[model samples]
Target: MKKIDLSKQEIEVVQEVLDHWQEQGLLEQSKVRELRENIDERGFEWKALARYAFWVALASLIFSVVSLFSDDTLVKFVERFYETPNLVFCIFFGALAAMFYVLGFRNKKKFPEKTFSNETLMLAGSFATAACIGFLGQVVDRNTNHFTILFLLSIIIYGVLSVKLQSKLIWVFTLVALGVWFATETAYHSDWGFRFWGMNYPLRFTIFGILLTVFALWGQPRISVLQPFQSTSYVVGLLYTMLALWCLSIFGNYSDFAAWTGVRQYEIFYWGLLGVILSLSLALYGMKVKDSVSRDIGFVFFLLNLYTRFVEYLWDNMNRTVFFLILAVSFWFVGRWSEKIWKKKSAY
Candidate 1:
């Protein structure tokens, strides 16, 4: 259970949090098995620091992303004006980077780290910040000096935030940043421009998928929802869908010489195959988890099927009511089935 300094609401929620922790014992077990550390044993000891760190990680990520995409005239003007080395900016950035390094560096622990609660939203914020900074570096089109300065500065500031929040998500995020760095450093020598906007790198996509999968797997020790894990599920689902799209797009026939725009016949076949396979897989998984995980996954596949049928509707533009009715009926059946499974599990 988390203790909130500000309000009774946080204190009142303690019971719910305890139930949540008990329910999520699976994750606790997994972590213990992996790290040989008793994270679950720590209980509410790290709540405040972890929570704060999580927020900073999230904020840092968001700030970095926004900074990268910022079209702000003032920002641009500042960049133009202070184009050279400035001790003031350097000092400003240096401190934050130092903090980020200290917090996120796994081995740099003041004392051997023991327990930690994962905070998905906050860690996402951290990753987003790194991404934004990376993007900004890309935009500036520099060799190393400016980006390194920014990167270092951000690492310290956000790093401290990560510690304060005790966000495991930030730790995950740091891993991702490391991976991305590895990718860029190895293939293109820290050339992010090519990777972000360059040709499709299948391996990179695969890596991204793996990362999302890790998030999803780690998030759900049990079926209950939380801010971080739910986000992971959504991301995993989205990435899986994107993977299907990317593969199909690859197989589709395109114009050899002349310009034309339309999906190929092979594309339809691939999508249909994926839809069927995913639906079947989800239904199979439904036999295990009595929660909406399988149901939601299956829904994505069903939605794809509906889309294909709707495309056929476009050609005929008739019997649209039948299509809608089929969707409604399918939704109802799935809803009932899900309720039955959940109720049965609860009764047990």
Candidate 2:
């Protein structure tokens, strides 16, 4: 009895399908009319507007803070406050984080429909928590360059909070903190060198990503509390791996830019080849398994690799107009192919 509010395009698609069904004698005219009557065309997309407004508000808040600090009086006030003990900052931000979390939880419980606002509060809490941790680290600083411990602490704190709150936002911060810990820990062990056991940063993260992805696929599903985070973990792990692979394709295993430039492009072709093979393999595997996330990542990165290769191989050799023309045609073909697939799926 409830009318479904849909966009204009969606309404048209439903109408077209109803018309087709009536033409084929599959649906009665009266039934088609009734279905059409239940479809309400939306005049505006308020959800999208709200999402954009929230982002704009965040940007404006940042600009406002910048503008406030640009004033000489405010600048002097902050300069005087800079002499305050790190312990004070730590306690202040820790209290702020607690307040935000409490408010976020209260709102989530009382007004569950305010999804964006609830998450925004949680995000603010996460930032405040990070600031609290950072100041705590500074308070205990021994000039040992062992501040990587703070990240480890963050991983523990954020992980506990995420599970307690069932918050994907906090879980994302937990993952980010884990990555920071891993990277910094490795760098510290290697005495801040570019290579750790002959593996550069990208290579190191590629391995880390593989391990994370494997754990998400094999381990997370078995753990009851972790199941909710499985998709986020899987997606983030793949993004890390694919992005690292892209970087490897560009820079190879070289430690520095100078070394990379000295080596011929053909010498590093193997990395690119490996990236292409993995991308294609993932795409095919995703299609077979009906994993939409994997399929999309694989396909997108496959195209990215091709475009990068096109630029690397043909940029100097081809005419500027011809290069862009080929690029445009390729994108057009891709759009047409996607449309065909969408239409076929819709027909079903």
Candidate 3:
């Protein structure tokens, strides 16, 4: 019953949604009547869009496959296309969108009693479309120039769709997409990437905050393990910290510590140890206070200890006994604290 103007790239999405809706026959009787009455409003545009998506799919596959036949195709393909992976990604998405429409029609008929078969189809189609395009670009050309951008688009798209649809599966995909993007981006760049700390840190922090907010809003009364954002929080948090610490460990000098303290090595070690202790203590406090985010942050500190120890002592293995001993003591303390919290709560 609603029609909206969208970008050229969004044609596939619109077509998929409409097609899925038509297939599911999910529109209410009154809504269906209204749609028919206003058939003149969007019918032609819709048909043309579906047709265009069809042609896009047909043409893209035909060309992509045909290109495989000619020796010149891969190398000689216009530099313009190479420059526009986004556009190519979009077209590839459009094509998969077309395929999804056909598949949705079949699935719709198969599950006639289902209320949201169409919405699922639409989202699944969109994700598949984006992934397929990305895969093609990544594999065939071996040029992953805009890969981060593409992955971000997919993740953002899934996040939005999940919210709109209230579909946990969509949320799951969104989280997975973000996790993969973070890992990929981080694994590739460490010290070299830290130079852009001023710009990248704020941007990433903002994104993380926003994602956490969205996740909180979406969760409403409580956070869900089912939530796409949940599993990734630990991973992404630890990853960012690992990267940041890598920066610190590489550049942190004893002279820098000497300014603040009497003995350089001992001071640095004390400060690091203090930070780890406080971070862990805060995590325990958070867990006691029922603050999930703080607890998560605390766990990240534990992860930091693991990472710092591994990196600093990989060849030397000097902290072997100390590391394991500290680990045991920390766990014991945490366990005692947890028992206290539970006992107090149980008494209440």
Candidate 4:
């Protein structure tokens, strides 16, 4: 019989459960022994190792290319490379992107188990595509900063490719491109001002994040092809929302550090309070709906807001030792509460 391999912690949990069942006369001792014989603790985490290896390999490849280009012998070649026409570079990178995408698609079909490798190829293709778009932008430079068009083009291209290839990696790039386009387009409309329509970057992005999250929750589920990407989109949207809110809590609507420094920390108290309230509300809603992702993010951001407030309001007035002690106690209490909740859930 094939053995089931599990992590040490998982094996321990299974053992404890089996022991409890036997003690309660729910499972036969012989049956428990048989089950135990078929289970083995995994000796290593090859999947994690493979993931790290792939990223390291990619970094090394990049470094090697950079080193080769920086060599003294390649000075003339490097200068000439820079002198090369934007259109030529654009075409070259475009071809490279096409080749990587084709290869990645072929690999996905032929060896479905090589998930990391296939995704890496797709990642390379995405980078190449971005380079191609950038060069294309340079090729059509008209002195005006119309580079926002390139980001829009990237969003369209990546969006199409993601759907066609059913690739989460490409979809992530599409979302990133969308964000870039949104930021640049807004800035352009505002004449590159620090504030757009009386809102700073953080405030503007906070609104953008809310809209993105709403779309992910309500709009994404309606599309059949997008169902697979729903969770990713939701998480990314939430991350954007939470991060922007954090920034808003710190910076409020201030466009510059100097402006922010002129106001007391209490002046931004409303923004922090808003973040805390929203996070708490989300946490409650997530718990009611049994949404783990929402619950985790909400709880984490709620704690973050509390910590930020603690520092902002009490750091100068309180002793360092007392402040750290309070933080430590709070963390310990939270951990104990979380453990109790985990136990209750496990019992159920």
Could you tell which candidate, 2 or 3, scores higher by lDDT?
2
Where does the lowest 10-residue lDDT sum fall in candidate 2? 53-62
RMSD to native for every prediction? 11.9, 1.8, 18.3, 2.2
Best by lDDT: 4
By TM-score rank, best first, the candidates go 2, 4, 1, 3
lDDT of 4 by residue, 1-348 (tens): 999999999999999899989988999999999999999889999998999999998899789778877898877667867878889999999999999999999999999999999999999999999999999998886587968988999999999899988899999998889888989999998899878899988888888888888988899999988888888888888888888999999999998889889999899999999999989888988999999999989999999999999999899999999999998999999999999999998774
Which parts of model 4 have CA positions greater than 4 angstroms off?
61-77
Quantify all predictions' global Cα lDDT against the true fold: 0.50, 0.90, 0.56, 0.91
Q: Write the per-residue lDDT of candidate 1 for residues 226-283, one digit (tens) a residue.
A: 3434554445544554454444334332322132135444444654565566665665
Of candidate 1, the 10-residue stretch with the lowest lDDT total is: 251-260
For candidate 2, lDDT tens digit of each residue in 1-348? Answer: 999999999888888899989999999999999998998989899888878887787778778789879999889888998889999999999999999999999999999888888888888899899999999998897577988999999999999888888899899999999999999999999999889999999898888989999999999999999899999999999988999998898899888888888987778888888888888888888989999999899999898988888898899899999999999999999999999988988777
Q: Which stretches of candidate 1 lie over 4 Å from their true place?
A: 1-81, 86-94, 100-167, 174-260, 265-267, 289-325
Candidate 3 error regions (>4 Å): 1-130, 136-144, 175-194, 197-289, 296-334
TM-score of each: 0.46, 0.94, 0.39, 0.93
Highest TM-score: give the candidate number: 2
**Higher-TM-score candidate of 1 and 3:** 1
Clashing residue pairs in candidate 4 (N, C-alpha, C atoms within 3 angstroms): none
TM-score, candidate 2, is: 0.94
